[model samples]
Target chain A: MPIPSEHQRPTRVTAKESAFTQLQQWIIDGTLQPGEKLNDIELAEALGVSRTPIRESLQLLEVQGFVKMYPGKATQVTEVDKESINDLLPPLAAMQALSTELAAPNLDENVIIELEETNNRFAKAVQKEDYFTALKIDEDFHQIIVDQAANKYIHSIVASLQTHVRRLFFHNSIILTEKSIDEHKDIIRLLTEGNGEKAASIMRENWLRAIDEFHSKKTD
Target chain B: MPIPSEHQRPTRVTAKESAFTQLQQWIIDGTLQPGEKLNDIELAEALGVSRTPIRESLQLLEVQGFVKMYPGKATQVTEVDKESINDLLPPLAAMQALSTELAAPNLDENVIIELEETNNRFAKAVQKEDYFTALKIDEDFHQIIVDQAANKYIHSIVASLQTHVRRLFFHNSIILTEKSIDEHKDIIRLLTEGNGEKAASIMRENWLRAIDEFHSKKTD
Candidate 1:
């Protein structure tokens, strides 16, 4: 029954896209609880669109595994399992690493300065224990490199995988730390030196470490 | 007008899915040429369904970059770009390498033998210069590792990217040769020995080589 509030909805190029993006974000951020049935009629009214775009958005959401559709029946948000981290991180790590490698040779002074400023804010947010702000900042730092990579396939794929990653963070209390802040420094230095291979390995490790942290948290 | 014949349509559990799969394949294989407008009514009749499912299928296809839809206007298949190889291969190579690494310690004798047999058939097909069969058999060979890796995210993502790769191959006449067969043998050997790092490197290189071939072919 929960849908994004009027003020919180995304503004997209089309009614369908706006609905899909808002629905996907709500599901990812836990605003829409898993296993909750989605009412297309209600969603359409809330999004200020007709049922047609809402139905089309749900079909796209089904394709992305955010929701499940049952013919002549209800649509429900898919359950979130911590174990999905195992399935999610490996591919995400590879894509992030490839993005960094591709971006390394191309990093300029302006981008390097931007990376440092973003990391400073990220480190401060982590220090303040404001993990939500910190995680968003982390995405901004990585976004610089992802933009530099300029490969549309990697761009979209990484964005999709990172949605699941953000969901995990929301559910499991954001596994980042001062250690990650230091790793970001190493990443920046490696990129500055144009040593793309080492930068890529660090970037891969930067993500791979999260899996280990997830296991340790699970056992605790 | 070039929709797949009824006999060639893919069967799915739902009408919407069947329409989606068949339409996607038609676009990928160039049965529906780029810039060609799609009519939902005709597609619905061709696939023996209602227009609703055809519309839904087109929505999904647009998200996958196979189509572009205009509100109150026609939908058309997107163009195939040989230059997409630059955007496609790096991320794909990374995922494929990670899949290989994840599968290495897990590869049993049965999978190894399957790889060997698949490679043998692939080599024979290449020798006969039947590149279509050769390319499909190549998919089977890597699919062994992909299955062994057991990562659903990677499986889905690699499948999506590889679809674009296949379209490029089809458009560019399948830029493969005998050298790829030898590399497949080496890939099989390294995977069998459980040397995951070396195996991953080879897997990455195996896909990366296609980029050079794409460039060389572009020049020609």
Candidate 2:
């Protein structure tokens, strides 16, 4: 077969990346349970790809601490060990705290109003038992802080740390809607008043509180 | 042909992981410059692997923020702008500062001595112009602090951040030998005195100072 010309366009989505996305979603959505062994043949067949892509997907998962690979044994979705799970808290707290700090000086009157509107929407979403919408609104509020910070690398790294925390949020039994919204309102109030230190401290506390709730469930 | 058993041992290393390792090394070593395109077909042929593994490796690299992929454009090593890099520092500093604080209280006397000895070795290596060995010693000293922190998740995340920072250090012309030894001694002194706060603060300053040096070089 002749090589594709340099000007010829490849498909937008590559097979290997597709497998990676699907596998990641499966893990996140709990379709793949923790410690479930991933048979390469079965995964490839399920993913409608060759074993090469399936193997590659597994390696990516392994690096994210989502999957464990044994030399002679099968690759399995990793169980969240207590220590590993709790260790996520400090960095999450730090990142949120930093985001708030960076965002405080940058927020103008219009942005503060926008943040309050988002907070109000989050409250309504929680009241209506719309966890999905609430999650999005919640994420958006935090995203604004990082976006305003104008740090692409920092924002990206924080985004990765947030992914790890999202799994715990799914498992959390606590309805943080009311408390979180209230705290978020306070964050907005502080930012509006130009109280950066208090805003950052409160944001850090918000993350720590969520972590505490998750740990309580983990222990029980 | 008889199929291999599912339980068949995977004694040999997989080709995919090898390719991934090589790619990661290139990015870390600055051999693959930021914004440099990584053509899958070209990389695969050069590395003696099929495109499958190379594409998978790129996916992982994308998640790590080492590479960026646009649907129509080429996949290239990412060049994070300065603003985003600054946004990343606070949390990293917070994480390492927390590590130092936690480590100070829990560090065993012998481990503290071992770290000091590693610092001395670093000084010796620097004196002999063995930059590689000096670098390893520097890594070991910081690692000892992380090991004492007793938080694996924090260490893992910080380790990822270190990968990017190491590149900055590579370009930094500062010998860092005399000043690093002095800073290490100060840190050790504070730890021995059971001054966790002071030790953590000093460590934070050391990192901040390094970042200042990094920024200066970038501008120069």
Candidate whose TM-score is highest: 1
Candidate 1 lDDT (Cα, 0 to 1): 0.88
Error of 1 at B55 (Å): 1.7
Measured with C-alpha atoms, the lDDT of residue A94 in candidate 1 is: 87
Query: Deviation in angstroms for A29 in model 2?
Result: 3.1
Per-residue lDDT value at A165 in model 1: 87
Residue A197's lDDT within candidate 1 is 89
Give the per-residue lDDT of model 1 (tens digit) for B22-127.
9988988889998899999999999999999899999889888899887766799999877888899998888889999999989899988899999999999999
How well does chain B match by TM-score in each candidate?
0.90, 0.82
- Runs in model 2 lying further than 4 Å from the true structure: A1-11, A15-18, A47-53, A82-84, A127-133, A172-174, A215-220, B1-13, B71-73, B80-88, B125-133, B172-177, B217-220
Cα deviation of B95, candidate 1, in Å? 0.8
lDDT of 2 by residue, B1-220 (tens): 7876776764778776798789988886778987899899999999998997788788777777789888667799987444433545566677778888888878778987898899989889988888767766877888889888888667877787776666554544334546778888899999998998898888877766665555665652
| TM-score of the first chain of model 2 | 0.83
Best-performing candidate as measured by DockQ: 1
lDDT of 2 by residue, A1-220 (tens): 7866766655578677799889987886668988899999999999888998788778877877778888567799987554445677777777778778888888888888788888888899999998767877888888888787766656766776666656655544334547998899889889888899899999988877876666565543
